[model samples]
Target: MGSNFFHHPNGWVGTTPWWKDAVFYQVYPASFKDSNGDGWGDIPGLISKIDYLHQLGVDVVWLSPMFESPQKDMGYDISDYQAVYARYGTLEDVDQLIEACHSRGMKLILDLVVNHTSDEHPWFKESRSSKTNPKRDWYIWKPPRYDSDGNRMPPTNWRGYFAGSTWTWDEQTQEYYLNLYGPFQPDLNWENAECRAAIYEVAMRFWLDRGIDGFRIDTVNKYSKRTDFPDAPVTCPGVPDQPAPEMWCNGPRIHEFIHEMQAQVLAPYKAVSVGELSNTPLPKQVLPYVSAAARELDMVFEFSMIRLGTGNLFHGKYMYTPFPLSVLKRHVATWQTFIEGTDGWHTVFCENHDNGRAVSRFGDDSTPELWEASAKTIALWQATLTGTLFLYQGQEIGMRNMPASWGVEEYKDVESLGFYNEAVESGDEKRVQAILHGLRILARDHSRVPFQWDDSPNAGFTGEGVTPWMRVHDQYRELNAANQLGDPESVLGFYRKALGLRKEHRDIFVHGAFKLLAPQDESLFMYVKESGEQVGLGADGNRKKALVVMNFTSRVQRCPAISGALGCRKGDERLLVSTLRSGLARGRVEELRPWEGRVYLNFQP
Candidate 1:
């Protein structure tokens, strides 16, 4: 009956300047829209779609890399830090994109790939030309070891993030270049203060000067490295892989580097940073970036749920295993405890440009009706959680996973290809199947599919005969945003309603304590959000309190037992929204239909 408490030493919970309670929509520019009909998406095309995002009820937009690149890893390979890819558009086009987003009251978060750059980058080109080049120390380069046969060997046993050896021999320099990811994505030497300062200066000025929002720091955890450069002791053997990237990931001075960057660049601008700290655990590893004291990153995108294993027998070895529902509960619980105790912020998302669709990954896709209910239920969960909820473009309409039949040829992700090659070379059919199983669930290419704007030809992404860089999902005909916008009960509508709830009651949902009242029940995910008397725009506009309840299963499930509140009798429950079934008379105890969710007012106003 008491209001939920909020502890804020800095400022009001929801009134922070950097997107404290906003919903973010991610745009993978290459697949978002195409203006010149050049068969690829560009910035001008994104500018044309700002209206769509506004209507979708999002206040922040996170764009995948638009920097000038060789398209080797899509746009993740940066060739020019300040320039925009001509294929996507010019620098003018990027400037216009930022302008248009702000004009609509939306913030743009640029994706910064500082961990590595394309080999063709002028800096890298010069560094690799000769051992004594002026930029030779710009990247992580070392002399090769003379083997027993007098042949030079790689300096260490570091594994490439994209597969193969982390060290690539450079014939010109007679040395080896350190590559954490693809061979072309040579690692930057953060130990070199000059290299670090140059990138920070460019990034800060590029945005601070233009008044852009902030950045989504790509692989922010991977910038630091050990001085010894010792080989990682293999935990899982026969997998001649980088034994442990701990030697390089989250190194000694990463925090210092980030703090310096924050002091010079982010803090002055009051900008947001969503650090992409993949392959790292939350709470222990990811939470520091968003701590109030760190002042480094505003939020961190944790990948616990996104790494779940699908129904693949060979999931773990290939890193594609659908984690069970229990794993989801444990992860969420861990995050909730940390945020509740600290002045830390978290980013909530089911899908991004890097993971598979939510409904397909988490839903019990045995039937269509369950799919619909599950989608709405998940959206309700996303809305109520105390963080910035990011919805991938197609997620609004409940898009499912790419076809199971999609072969290796249909995939474009470097990670997936590398795993496949490793599996095939091992000559183990069982391992190959297991690896592909994991790839089916976690590959970045899943969320990179074209936006399902309408049921038009090619999902209206490109003209006929102009094949997209990746295959357009076939479900676009039935699942595009155009049709859903008009339907009251569509997934798109449910998302709009979810955002509307946050907009209507930002205090409680965004800034209040999150308690899972019924976490163990297999049928439901019930929780409550309570804001103190000083709070406004929470679950209860009145000084009264509100209780949030959701039924994750598809069956009429009753609350175990309660005294102060029952189902609907006494007008005690003001049903705000329901996914499966609604309409209950006052003073009656009842059950929730399968896959149903409802928010109720707990006390009298």
Candidate 2:
């Protein structure tokens, strides 16, 4: 009956909790909807869309940062932790959004941006005023390095996240401040006890007191920076300019800080925290942050899958190559297997506000016909995974990447603008084309487009003649939610149907076992999800069992390990959901086309 045990693969009991089964729909408040005729989406607009999410089979709404910010990084640069952004309405509007979610029997979690704070934030302002100030220790600060010649230099050879040195020189204090992100966003000093305590209060007495469920902590692993401030090794081969990921991530004090925060606040409120762990490459590195025994966080989202496109962090978004299926299988299977017996859980996601569209990244979205099929295929893959499903806004209708024709005017993300200038400075037209093309495929601005509610002008996100913060995707006229609401073949309709399976067979989809099938094959991606021997959580006495096969390529491919994965012949399984047309037969796949995904139920060994 304890929450720390679950049904292990060896036919014994293991612990799985309610958080393991939660399905989160991640929404960017600036792009979700606009109730008023204002150009920007607001809390009231999100409140107006409760029924839409409820119908999409959502269990929780993980709204992105709405906390008071200067909009430098689109709210990641929080100016005030306790207050809502003026553009997003008041705290009452947030309460209304929360109440609406609760009324629809859904949970809501705010985005916690505690890793860093905006330079405009009062804490940062005071901390930057004087070196000896009491609050000066609240942020990472160190004297600049001086050589024998008295030449000033950064404290370390560290660069983080975006383009620039990690250390920001402050004129007022005559000291260099550490920032793993934008210059305006200074990294917090977790080493300070008062800083940690104050953050705990913000999470507990300030936000949690308002009756919200939990937080999705952004840049969680960056909480503790390597203390020595030494020169970092290069993260990727041939990318000597970029500092190693270890230089500023997964440092010594991460677990200690997380556990202390949990003990002081999270446990008391019984609320959950899912941390966004960037640059952590291994499961062991990931385990401590989310292990139930550690009592740190409920879960952590490791960026292994999403990084497949660029291969590594240093490669950045400029390297646009088709994600090799071979590498994707290895990364996924390794993490899935390592976390199987542990209390740590995985945060399953294909796309989010920080990345490109799922249908475009992993699916074939070059044309209209391929877009719908590939989108549904990805949706099916997302829902059937064995962890908390995080569905980004517009993911249901298969939103594609931004158009290649759009220039810097259409782009809002700082990364895109930075990369654009860097490319132009190279004096190569081909390089410029490549950089822009890559942005269309990988920039965060692509996902920040206004959500398409209908086929009306402005896509029903805002009224006529109002300019949104970012441009809407051009395809919204044909692929809007209104068009897909009833059509069974539409991408939205497909998601609704596939999500129903999670309710019908919770054990298999939620707290089930995940095993990668045909890990060596480079074309078709296959896997199996099965429940433990005991009767799963539902009223039925049967345990969960299913086989999922997907073709990542445009070419037809057979199920390479049909017998090995399911322990049964092809005819023995029943097809429940498929992105393509028709039933499968024989050992070889029956007409498995490009970008096709299929799930089999009633499958037994």
Candidate 3:
């Protein structure tokens, strides 16, 4: 309904930059591709796939950790600060990745995991070498409790993010070091100025000088903890056993640390930051990090929306539960309202490395017939929302979740395996069942399955002769980029169109004010993105407007036309995009088929 290029009233809506306008595609290096016959994906593999990304219409690529590590947490636990992982190639391979991306007019960013390092890291090795070692203070270490008796407990009642006690005793040094995650991954002490400065160098100077664009800050909210080092408070009302990460998440001085990092590094390079803030639901806890005045981060990712719909009776995140459409509506609407016209910004993503496949989690991907419609419906929603669109690799092809019959042995994620062992030790079959179901639905492995590039053996991800790092999802034949790339009705083709529309209509999709139009209906998630008064025909091309009505259920819904609800004339609404054959008519009446989404426009040239 407008020109090929749409500009905001000003150069941008409100000092917005390319970060807010670009379409993001996340790549998990271990599974994206294998350049060498080694089965594991490397930087050169990513470089080889750059043209595929450009052809798919993505402008920004966010890679998961590719640094040197023990693979305990899939590279999340850093062993070396400046070198790339041996399996993922060398430092020169990383340089080639940056250059290749820039040549294609795209930006590449690495995952910044500074909150903790692998126990094998030189800093931790020396820190645990002896209590008096100069590097001992680099990590959070304390003496065991009950000094009077030989037997003792951990310093506090804190819990690890993966499972068991957060404190691990070091045989070399009598003191216990805090490890909020896996046993091999110890938390770094940000209060120590030296530790802070060194992490700053890793996050700022080193990579920035290497020609990389920016970072997706990992566990950004957990960088600081209370000086008193008290026990973490329980999060749920009755679930006392749950890890109380609330004590460290959004801690007292986290903002200060981020502000310093931003001032020292980000400002100079004009780089962007998208912080992954987890384990909290309060908007107040997250807003400060992304507020422009706060100078902490450019964008903040809150998990409440994804959390509220997942989990079983045991916890809120790990277990599986059908996502209620009404809950998602409320959660997303709250975020959209909070960041409107403010210095802060929002991020839209249905799945990441930590989450499950969107088509399987939120949409109905139980059968072959439901796959295409379901994936397109959710992908369109993410692309049109008023924020940056983060699309995980293989999402464009509607990759399904792990096989239903597969056992936990098929999973490689440290958190999933660790928690499963804990449940098995408790001798609680019910708890074990919940954990297994949760792993199938919400585990990190669900998204970690190899990216399906084609129909070859191993889905064209790794060499046929080599074994992939993780098992590829079994349904790669029916759903893969090579098969769906040209089919207009295929999920991959739909994604290309959605991404193109987002780029062409940035003003309407990225800057236009968002309003939830049909909040009362649990079966529908309907909203509008418009900027100016809804006048009659012949409006200026600068007036960006789009009305999106989505049926999130599996059954056909009798959706009444809301021309009035969207402040448009009966005939002004013109269907621009739809997953169903029967698109929206010019009037106030209609029905949406299962998992159908329709976008309407105001004026057409």
Candidate 4:
């Protein structure tokens, strides 16, 4: 169902959907935990941790792909939509997982990778069998082009997400098939009604029927591509195949296909749909997909917040550059204000399976002294925002980037490996070093390390003497969950308390009106959230208000006075939480320590 709005005593108040205030926890299956000593995390391992997740106050669990695949793109290249990957577990294990999550009042959502299928998939195999096969149109295939010297070339000069050309020639069929991602994963032809029907039956209905609460759609905006097969304009200099997001992303029929999926599967089951709308930056462009009136998706993940410091070169996002904190503040304010009172909703997240650790990327993770404080600061920043908050695995315990000493050989992510291979082939040592530095700061594999359960071997991710599929972070001995379980000042403890506060004051933190304070401050991020009487709720004349102030740098900064905005005098506000645990219960915070954050509840005059 869509958002419902009604008139209250003070004004109009919008009633949020169930997911609006929910806390989502995303688990990268292979890296979360391992059972059976197989060195790979599975459904059983997840089932065993249900109590821990519930204790962490998570409302929904979003799992990355666990479907049958060739493990080409980390289970993204699905070979069978209806079957579970053997390494992850069987169909029965998934059923048990559903039961376990539902028993605790938590919902489970799977990552839906429908943009492409593994080349080894039976349908793709049949389609490539011959030129006139009945299933030939199941995937996008076009005739090859030739140069003046009779050198055969692919259909278009569009680069794949992993690298190289988007088109891969099929020797048997004598045609080039389009694969926006890896060559082993062929894109489906959404224009074909039969193909669309098949995808809905297996990918959507199959999972929804199996009791999955909803889906986190992968590459949702890249389904429909320009059919004319035009060469991409040279955007990055010296690159033969240019990135053509403009032609593929948000194509003409993208909405139509999403609406169809909504009607056929999601709406019927009343399932939550959070689309990964990559390359769609503007809030206006994302509005149509998530607006209540559209009947498409419930929300979407926007990349603008995460791409803050990257550039426009060929190594985009893999190149690191320092950006002013004001730019990040402006982007957050813009999105928050744009959707403040609209039917559209947004997803608030900084860390996921795709990005570097939040603490390392955004917070000061330079020393042991700053780790917990900075992680708690990031947590407070996310908790106060107006959207569905997502916490990736290991974020609660302050997991960080892989150690700088490790080389490219330690990286297991396809993107990181591809970038390294390409960089080294150029024989430019300085350029390679620069790219490696960026990888150390921004590689996706940084987030894929095994979960640190305790100081035990392999971070307790796998049994002793069993090497995990990926290496555990080196700091696990000091940063595992067990070490922080009892310490109230630990990042895990702070997250539980912060999430509990958000739940306790759902109206104020979830549906409250947001106002940015000290917007131009380079070293501080401060905002106010007011609900209840101010937002047309609390007919009994009760008003709820909260003020959040954060120091974004390693140096102390004076917190700008927010007492005026909260309508409370200095020292009259109740201190709810602070990163430092300074033991001050109620007072005006005049100064904030390095990487410090504090929240307060305002007193009514």
Candidate 5:
């Protein structure tokens, strides 16, 4: 089916393909594993884990940047567009990993980062050399302006996504360069047709030739910027846009770029594409990108829930407001309702390498029992929803947040460093402490901490005397995989059970309609998915239907009784799986143990 057809949710109306329900697992390469003991994870390391992913029961594997990079921004700072990083082994290693995933009946989704390029990249090198160079127009450049006092002024007021000014003055070219990220990462000028075409070509041929199932485009909507580069009105006190970022983010030409990408590249292969839409409001501008015309993406990841910890001052000053569950449920419910009747698809995620653990954010991770239950409940809630569920590494094992004691030296994320420097440089010790503490709760390193495969040193990710790039969590001794695989109540086991239900009841869970019930309850997060007589892809034609009730609050609570279509007396229902007990009597209105949840299979009214 064509890209345009993806917008209609009516199960591929008029030859459009349907992707309403799928599961994607995000893999961060460097922290994933180390095959050659270099202290960094590689592709061969990934090839060894294909079976593990298959066992986890995910349909897609979304690998983080493996493209050549300077490691300045981890792998997000790309130096080469086409070549695989040598530290990750040869291109053949990637080929082998792709084949392994496909052989197990799973698809691979490459992380496509097109927003900016590393300063070390050859294209940037040539473009920044001289004003008259043929590649000069490839990046956003501007002539410096002199202030009334003769001091040079930036062309615009835009600040970097990290921190600092977005413009860098280069005496050599006598021009200022535009960068929404770090100085080393230069934003490409999408207005330049040559540059745009080059990016599209690179995105196309790689997946087309290599047989990748799709792509998860990172910072995708930022590809287009405002034309005039008008100065943004002040929103925050310190963070001002030089001609504002609003002028640049989601520019007028964005749809054109998406349409071109779809027409020239994505459409021909019938490949799936999802944009990582940052700072963009949902059910409005973001939704159109994934609209029925298929002009751009298969789905877009809206970050409202991810930004919960930020409060009102999200990116500016800091606060310790533990994200409220009410706020989380509201945003999720609104988004789900907005796309409930659309052909456009939604990409669901609770954790990613760039964020902290969901187990820590949503549940009590300090204790083993609560940790296991919370992790299981989160997995089921996301998986059973009506979109592509994205699971981050270490999530299956219910990884916790970074240790509060991990000081500056132990951190590797740029966001952490930027906040640390800003806090100290500005002499706000109290604010610094708060930001650092928040980092412990929200930074990507918490998720990137070494995968606890076993109780071995370095959490089985590296050997002794080999320093890891980041500190591994200290709980590896007790929380490692070797122990969890034996315990059915472990977080890993609960994940298996959750994924198993998703796979086993594909028609009801994967492609079924999501009916969110009891939205306002603070203690109970309840919902039901009705297959309504649709048959799964490979089943014996038996209809599948289920009622999934999750108790989000960490206390015993009574879920709202189900009537109408779902037949249940008072509350007598067989417990399919529970963190505390085995059998549940019908119409009993049983108590839900703290952080506990249950699902009933073939439940009838």
Candidate 6:
């Protein structure tokens, strides 16, 4: 595998990087743990959990934003890039946490949010103070345009990501400022050289100087924008302005700015960066950012898989229909095959701070019996894939979406609240109900609930008398981590076993050739991994193959024979791992139980 190289378009050859073999775990600091009983998780609380992460076989820890802010967008709007929020800990606490992770053979990366800043940030405040202020060019500002009737209008017909017009009028300056997200979070002007340098100093250099590993850059592809700011074409009816992702996402100067960042800080520290490419999913557009020859980013988180069953316009991610399993298989196959032996890399994940739980969205979670089996099957499926695997905090314990009985007030996410309020103000009762139902299943708040550690009050996230920042899941009493620590068949236990198997057979699982079997089968997801012919493993004089079969349905399904495909006798196959505790055949699996998965090692041909 070491001799294999991917040729680039510029006539360069590249080898694998360190991040390809690592497993990343994302920690949303505000909901992870609370050390002072303040109803919020802190850096000190995270420091106490390093041993838990190390035992789970995690190689890198990706922490969400904990920077100083007003909590409007839950730390995404940064007021001070260098200072940590008081509710979370101090800069000194972050230093201690970094040391703790390194002492245990782990690396830590921070969330870099440079696309925008809090309206209260000193830079933005000065920029908004007056048109002639020295920092006025730090943010995007435009003169107000008027109609023939003398009514004031925004510069362009573009909608904010949350809601309403993208350009907000500032009373003090008498000019409008661009805010792609909520009004409180103003977008920065990357076209200005001084603004770009200042952002690099605080957002990247300051953190790397503290001995951190790298960054999970938020909206990395949104750094540049079309200078003209043309009006977006109308897409949704009854809405004056429409979403213009094409105008700003992957703009003309995006690659130039990213390459500058790579040369300035990331390369010097030998850091690893996984960027969030908003609204860019095509392999042609995504390869330039992650290809080794580009020297831009190590990998990127694509949204094609997560946007499977989501809604658009008025619905806003609230789904009314079930996501088809056959469509998901095709999406997975497209990405896996496109970058099989290329210079580009991929990120494999099912849940994150922005999406619903994995088991509830992709697998069966209606019953306790099926929930455990389905969660284990999902774990096995992720482990056998060829990329960097990222597991959200509560995903290992089989967490599900919030209950539908809860009121809309229980959700604290800005996006969810905006969608609900807009539907209510329209005087549409049926639309309001449908939006509420969608929020229950697809809201970001479901992943932001406090982590369930034990059966105690507040799910062991806070003191018995203190109320949590968000409501704990109603099933914490039965699905807490303490009960699963001792049960070998628990979802958390199964995740550990599956990850261990990947590490043990890195040659076959990480560097092997991938082939999808039964592409049209909706109930079964079967694939093969071979190490010798494709990845230059034959030089070692040992060739190996692994067969992975998963049942993605609630009902029993027939399993296909694998002896011919693997070039091995029927009795020579060895079962490496199985999600079922019993009733699994030894050599050839004739049938698979509901939500079952199995991995077999076939003897060399």
Please give the lDDT score at residue 62 for candidate 3.
95
Candidate 6 residue runs with Cα over 4 Å from true position? 1-15, 313-315, 319-321, 532-543, 582-588
Instruction: Tell me which residue pairs clash in candidate 2.
Output: 5-14, 5-15, 6-13, 6-14, 6-15, 7-14
Tens-digit lDDT track of model 5 for 286-331: 7778886656788888988877776333255245576556667788
Query: Candidate 3 lDDT, tens digit per residue, 1-605?
Result: 00124344344333347788788899999989888878888889889989989999888899899988989889998999888889999988888889999999898888999889999999999999887889889999988887466667788776677767778888777888888888799999998988888887865579989887888999898988866877656665543344566568888888889998898888888777889988767677677888878887888788877665465323434666665677788888887777776778888888888877888878888777677778899988988888888889888888888987998889888888877887788798998998788888788888888889888999899878778888877878877888887786688888888888876677677766888876778898988887543333354333546888888888878776656655667887677888753343423347777788888876552
Q: Rate the local accuracy (lDDT) of all candidates.
A: 0.75, 0.80, 0.80, 0.86, 0.75, 0.86
TM-score of each: 0.91, 0.92, 0.93, 0.95, 0.91, 0.94
The true-versus-predicted C-alpha distance at residue 396 of model 6, in Å, is 0.7
Worst 10 residues of 1 by lDDT: 1-10
TM-score of predicted structure 1: 0.91
Candidate achieving higher TM-score, 1 or 2: 2
What is the per-residue lDDT of model 4 for residues 427-493, given as tens digits with 9 covering 90 to 100? 8887688778888988889999999999999989999999889988888899899999888778999
- Scanning candidate 3 in windows of ten residues, the lowest lDDT window is 1-10
The local distance difference test score of model 5 is: 0.75
In model 3, the clashing pairs are none
- Give the TM-score comparing model 3 with the true structure, all chains together: 0.93
Please estimate how well model 1 matches the true structure, expressed as its whole-model Cα lDDT: 0.75
Number of backbone-clashing residue pairs for each candidate, in the order shown: 18, 6, 0, 0, 28, 0
Clashes of 6: 0
Residue 126 shift from truth in candidate 3, angstroms: 1.3
